[model samples]
Target: MSAVIALRAPLDEDLTAFVQSLRSLGVAHRVAEQGNEQVLWVPDEQVAAQVRELYARAPQGDPGLQPAHTSAQRARPGFLAQAKHSPLTLLVLALTLLVALLTWGGDNYDAGRWLSFVDFHIDGQYIYFGSFAQVIDSGQWWRLLTPMLLHFGLLHLAMNSLWYWELGRRIEARQGALMLLLLTLWFGLAANVAQYVYGGPALFGGLSGVLYGLLGHCWLFQWLAPNAAYRLPRGVLVSMLIWLLICMTGVFELLQFGAIANAAHVGGLIAGCLTGLLGGLLARRLQRR
Candidate 1:
C-alpha cells in the first residue's frame, strides 16, 4: 500500500530514536529509503493526513511530536520514547550498564576500582581502600558520589537499574533533567556516605540506595502534593519499606546472601523524603498561586 504522507530532504541518524516514537504510537508506518529522505508511508490516506498534520505543526527536530490530546490516541511510551524525554535517566542507566560491563558484573576489581567510593591500591590480590578524609584532602570530591554507580553483580545492577529507570524518569519528567541530575547526585552522595560510615572501607556499591531515595521521594511528594507524576501505588512503597526492614534484620546476610547496605538505604531514604516534603510544599504553593 503506497502511502507517502510527506517528504523532508535528508533525514539523519537522529531519527533512529524518533522511529521508536512511531512504534510506541502504533503508527504502522516507516520512513522511506534515504533517497526519499524523511518521507513517511502508511496504510491509508486518513492516517497519512494525521501524519501530515503532526508533521506540519511541529517546529523542528523529528516533527516535535507532542503527546496526543486525547487518551485514545496516546500509548504509554516504549523505552526509547521514554529515553527521549528523560535523557538524564537514560544516561544513568547507560553508565550503570557500562560500569557493569567494565567490572565484568562486579568480579573485575582492578577495572572497577576507580568507580568505587574510595581510591584503592592492590597488592597480592588484596585491596586497600583509601580513607574518606584522604579523598577529601586530595580534592577527589567525586569519590563521595561515585559509589552509587558501582554494582557488585549483574543482579545488583539489574534490580537497581529497573527501579531507577522507573523512578528516575518520573523525577526527570516532572522536575526537568537538571533537577533530576542534581537530586540523583544528592541521593548518591547520601548513599555513599552512609555506606562508608557503616561498612567502613569495605567494597560496597550499587544504586539501590539511590533507588530507595527515589522511592521515598516519590512516596512523600505524592503524599504531600498529589501530583500525577509521583503517583505511585501505596502497596509498592509499603513493600519497599518492608524489604528494607527485612534487610535490616540481617536475614539475607545470615542466609549467605551478600551484604546489604542498610545504612546507605536509610540515609538516602531520609534525604529523599526530606527533599520530597520540601519540594512538595513548594509545588503546592505554586499550584495555589
Candidate 2:
C-alpha cells in the first residue's frame, strides 16, 4: 500500500534534492504527478510517522499528507502557459509554416517570384566574393532580414523549425521576443554578408546561421550569470558547439550531397556567439545603472 503527500505550494526546484534525501534515508517512494500540486508516494506503513515529522518542520501552506495513487496521470508542461507567456515563439512557428508554403508554392506557382524577394544567393565562381556583389547589385538589402525565414526543402524546414521552437521559447521568455528577434536579424544578416565575402560565391541560403546566433546568445547569457535565475549548465554550451559542428559536417560530404551553405553555418555560429556575449554585456551594463 502507498500514501500520497500533496504539497500545498508547488515544489519546482527543490524536488530533486528532496527526492535524493528520501532515497538516502532508505525510504521507498515515487513522484506520482507534477503540477501546481505535486503528489509524493510513500509506503503506507511509514506514511503516518513521516507525515507527522514532515508537518512539524515543513514550510507553511504545505498540505503535509494526503492519499493519492500511483495510477494518477503526471502533469506535463502546459501548452496554455507556454502560449500565454511566450506568444512570439508561437507566432514564429506560424510564420515558419507560411515560409514552407511559399517555398513549395513559389516553385509551382507563378507567385513564387515574390517569395524570392528576400532570399540571398551567391553569384559566379567566387563563392566568397560573389555573394556580396549580388547582395549589393540585387538591391535586396531586406534579404538579410528575410533570409532567416527561408528554407531549402521539407527536411530543412522541419529541422530548422524544431530548433526555433525549442530554443526560441526559452530565449524569448528570458530576453523578451522583440530582443531575440532583433538579435537573430543582426546575426543572421551580418553572418550572411560576411560568409558571402569569405566563402566566395557558389550561392547560399537558409536559417541555420541565425539559429547558430540564438545558440550563442543563450550560451553566453547563461555563462555570464551562472548563479542567475536561468543559469544553463556547462554541458549545454558544449552541446551547442557540437551541434554547430554537426551542422557543418555537410561540407565534408559535399561530393555525395547537393550544394550546402556551410559557410553561412560557420559564419552564423561565430556571429551568434559574439552577438550573444555583446548583448549580455550591454544588458549588464544597463542593469548596473
Candidate 3:
C-alpha cells in the first residue's frame, strides 16, 4: 500500500467516516501513525486519486458514492443484507422472539420455571443453582444464558430487541460476529448471576442488562478509539442512564412496569465498561504498533 494522505493528529469524525466509506467501497487501505500525524494508505496507486477525491468530498457531505452492483451482487436476496451486516444480531433476535412466542399467552407456559437460573425453594430458603451445577447434574447448561431470551411483555421484548439490534449490529459490523457473541454471553452471564445474587431465586429475566453492557461498551470504545465506527449519540447515553437511575429508584415498580432487574443492569454496565476499556486500549496499542 502507498500513503495517500497524511491526516492531522487526533482524527475527527469526518475522517473516520471517510475511512468507513473507503472500506465500503472495498478499497484496501490502512492507517499508519507517522510522528505527529496519521497517513491513510491505499494498496493501488491507480486508486490514489480516487481515494484522495473521496477523502476530500467526504468532509463536504457527499458520502453517497454507490458503486455499481454487478450481476453476482444482484443475485442475492435482500435478507442477505441483514445477514451480511449483522448475522449474530439477527440470530439473537430470532431466538429471543421464538422463546417469547413459545412462552407467551399460554396457561401452561411457566417462563420463570423454565428460563430462570434458579427456580427452586427449599423450606423458605432459596438455594442458588447456577449453570455449573445444572450442567453437571442435569446437563442444562443453557440456563446460564437463557435468561436473556426471556422477556416479560411485548413492550419489554420490543425495547430490548430494538436496542440489541442497534447496538449489536454496530459491534458486529466493526468487530465481527465472534466478538458480539462473546460479549453477549459475557454480559448475559454476569447480569444473570448478579440478579440471582441480589434478588435470590425470584423470577427475573430480560436482555436489558446485556443492552446496558452494549451501551457501555460502545460509549467507552468510541471514547478510546475515536476512529472506530461504534459511535453512540450523547442523547442515547443520557436516556439510558436516566432509565437505569429510575429503575434503581424503584419508580418502574411503582408505575407497574413489572420487576426491574436493577442488579443485572448494573452488572451488565460494569462488564461492558471494562470490556470497552480493554478493547480500546488493545486497539490503540495495535494501531501504535
Which candidate leads the pack in TM-score? 3
Ten contiguous residues minimizing lDDT sum, candidate 1? 9-18
Winner by TM-score between candidate 3 and candidate 2:
3
* lDDT computed for candidate 2: 0.59
- TM-score quality measure for candidate 1: 0.73
Return the TM-score for candidate 2, rounded to 2 decimals.
0.62
- In model 3, how large is the Cα lDDT of residue 9? 40
Model 2: residue 266 alpha-carbon error in angstroms: 2.4
- Of candidates 3 and 1, the better by TM-score: 3
Model 2 lDDT, residue 71, Cα:
15
Worst lDDT window (10 residues) for model 2?
Answer: 66-75
Best by lDDT: 1
RMSD of each candidate relative to the true structure? 11.4, 9.7, 6.1
Q: Across residues 1-289, which tens digit of lDDT does each residue of candidate 2 receive?
A: 5465533324233354344445445677766433333466666745646744653574321322322422121122466876787788788778767876866722432233233323333356421223345556978577555656656678878887787776777778777889767776776776676666665543345667777777777777655532122345668668867866765676546567565666777777777778667766765555445
lDDT measured at residue 243 in model 2 versus the true structure, 0 to 100: 64
The lDDT of each candidate is 0.78, 0.59, 0.76
**Per-residue lDDT of candidate 1, residues 14-40 (tens digit):** 344344456656788866533324466
lDDT string for model 3 (1-289, tens) is 5445534445433355556566667888788555324677776667877777666766432346533564334333365686678888999999998888887822223554577675443344554444445544986677778888888788889999999988998899879999999999999998998997788666678899999999889888778766535767789999999989988999878989677899999999999999999998877667666
